[model samples]
Target: MHNFEEATSAFAKASDAISLKVNFPRTKHSAMGLKPYLTKTVWVLSVISLLTDIASEMLYPVMPLYLKSIGFSVVLIGILEGVAEAVAGLSKGYFGKFSDHSGRRAPFIRLGYSLSALSKPMMAMMVYPLWIFFARTIDRLGKGIRTGARDALLSDEATHATKGRVFGFHRSMDTAGAAIGPLLALWYLYAHPGAYRPLFLLAFIPGVLAILLSLSLKDRQPKPSGKRQLPALFSFLHYWKDSPPAYRKLLTGLLLFTLCNSSDVFLLLKVKQAGLTDTAMIGIYIFYNLVYALAAYPLGILADRLGVRKVFTGGLLIFAVVYAGMTVDGGGAWYGLLFFLYGLYAAATEGISKAWISNITDKADTATAIGTYTGFQSICTMLASSLAGWIWYRQGANTVFAVTTAGVMGVWIYFLVVLIPEQQKSPGQGG
Candidate 1:
């Protein structure tokens, strides 16, 4: 086990490696002197995300294997994941709303990271199914608690013009951690085969580092709002009705698209059906993450240069092509190309959507607006996965792929016809 001092030292080293020292240039976007997009807060928050993801991903690949070893059936494992995800998804909105009402981001950020860090060792110490479920829920719950506030924190750091760049850079760093985490797990498991318990404890190192970094953030008190009324647990749902027309329009398109976007597991399963080796599948997934990490920042910059709506619509086009490609029979090489394109699709949409939303909504409502969308987004994702599974099991993979492709086209049309026009008519809503 790493001692506190060793963990702190590792955190310092990582901070030094990932830290950005930006020399902002005066541009049309910032004619009144440069607004530092890559602020210290942005980089610090991103580093915290990178470290936490590393910790979580290190355990993710081995989770099922470990669960089975501890006597959980396939059905039980599925139930565990479903429930854990539901908890995480629902809490994102509640906590996000709570953070906004309280006018504090740092406390939620700190508590969320701390809970996740503490959950690591708890997993290693227990083998009971209930205990494992409890620990897993804690891990995911931490994600829900922090997501809105963290993104809002990122949003607060940059202006409308720089939102895409800020978010894109953060996504790049976060995905880089995802890539690094699984490799580290593979390395450890290679050296000490079947030593999964100790690996859980080992993941704690990076998690602790994340928590320590989160603690350093100082909260800025937001201006007091007129209404301090406490929201219901599911009160974020009400935000949809009260939010701006542009926000509602954008969210409708986003949610409609999300309803068609299923889990990435289906993609892996597709390649598996093509007779690729396990090693090849893992390598391909890592390659996809690397592509996403590399492309996110550049695509974000492109979105800033062009328009966020344009780039986001372009991503949907890419999605349509990828799914259409999947319908054709492809071997490993062709599948590789599709996955690479898929990564680009993710990079273009994920951060860019949030940037788009932040630009159009009131700053005071940043967390609430994002929280509601993400909250419903999570539910839509669950439904999409279930619907896709049924279609794949009944109709077949190619049929599901075709269906998804058609859905993407419909969404693309809706964006061009409806959402874009709505944004254009609204004052100061262009991003």
Candidate 2:
């Protein structure tokens, strides 16, 4: 039975943490010019993310192709993506809320990576699309289970001054693994053309590594605050009610943007449409990840310096332009530029959004807030993907891209009018 004043004070702390200027105390001798400031947990989590993404990307790029090979249509692929993401979305808040009550993050993380690792074998043995769906859902379930708890753990380990850098560094490593994975997948395909089974098996190695890496992170029970008994799961709804207005506002803005941003498989399909072979398509994916990895750290630092309000808004703008470009029947250069801009937009937005949420919630509710935010956003993305698939199936690619661009534009405007003003209202935070 926490009082409203207690909640208010905690909310104020969170807002201040997120709204600090560049003049805040910074750590020198850091890994990426912000070194000695970050903790071991951040680096460890980065390693875990890197390994897990390697395993994921290894199978992911090929899965769509395999689905098509097995007589699945684009709409089916979209539905599959939507359903899988919806499962992940719904699970995140539950796991996060549970983690807050239990106050142990490592178990959920270990279990998540292990489950995903096990799923690789399922993919390797798949002879039908349902098998693929089962494997992908299992993997995404693992992702859903770990993401909230892991992110909460990172925020716990980092100081306010280092939050952006910590998340950014993690994303860079994660994207680096994404870059490496496609290369490995490409090699396997090159060496053994049309042989997907071996590639699936090879993916198992990195997933295992990710689980092992989770062992490096430490977890502890919460200090006995003598609060009322907490429910095991679904308590995050209470967390939202208790959290600050700014957090909820930011979540709404992010959700708005995500509703228009569907699963990226369609983009891959677009690249294929643009005249690249399977191998070349993979090469471009590698290129996109490289750009993402390169840009994430710098953008993260920029977020810490300049404030996330503008950087995040700028990211939405990039997405809008990229989607607009995609609507056209472009040459190679147009598609390449679109993919590259997407990479830049990801660097600017993804980690920053998590960092933003982490900065705006109570310390005790970190996992709950992050999980809730990610969960809702992902669910919206599922709906958006499903809609995009329906549109693409019926109206064609031009209409789908144009509609996406329009949706993002609307979101961008909402951020400017509503989301940004709340942050600006606080003195000392950048606009």
lDDT per prediction?
A: 0.85, 0.79
The digit string of per-residue lDDT tens for model 2 on 385-424 reads 7788899999988888999999899988888888433232
- Residue 388 deviation, candidate 2, in Å? 1.9
Model 1 stretches astray by more than 4 angstroms: 1-26, 30-33, 222-230, 421-431
The list of candidate 2 runs beyond 4 A from truth reads 1-35, 65-80, 125-134, 220-233, 419-431
Clashes of each: 0, 3
lDDT of 2: 0.79
lDDT score, residue 111, model 2? 90
Candidate 1 residue-wise lDDT, 1-431, digit = tens: 23644554354334323432333342465455454566778878989988988998898789889989999999999899899889988999898888888898998899999999999999999898889999989988998898888888998887777788789989988998888898999899899998899999999999999998998887767556586777789888788888888888999999999999999889888899888987789888889989999888778776776789888999999999999998888788999999999999999999999998888887777888888788888889999999999999999999999999999999999998894431334565433
> Candidate 2: minimum summed lDDT over ten consecutive residues — where?
422-431
Report the Cα lDDT for residue 202, model 2: 86
Instruction: Give the Cα-based TM-score of candidate 1 against the true structure.
Output: 0.90
Residue clash pairs of candidate 1: none
Candidate topping TM-score: 1
- For model 2, what is the error of residue 130's alpha carbon versus the real structure, in angstroms, after optimal superposition? 6.5
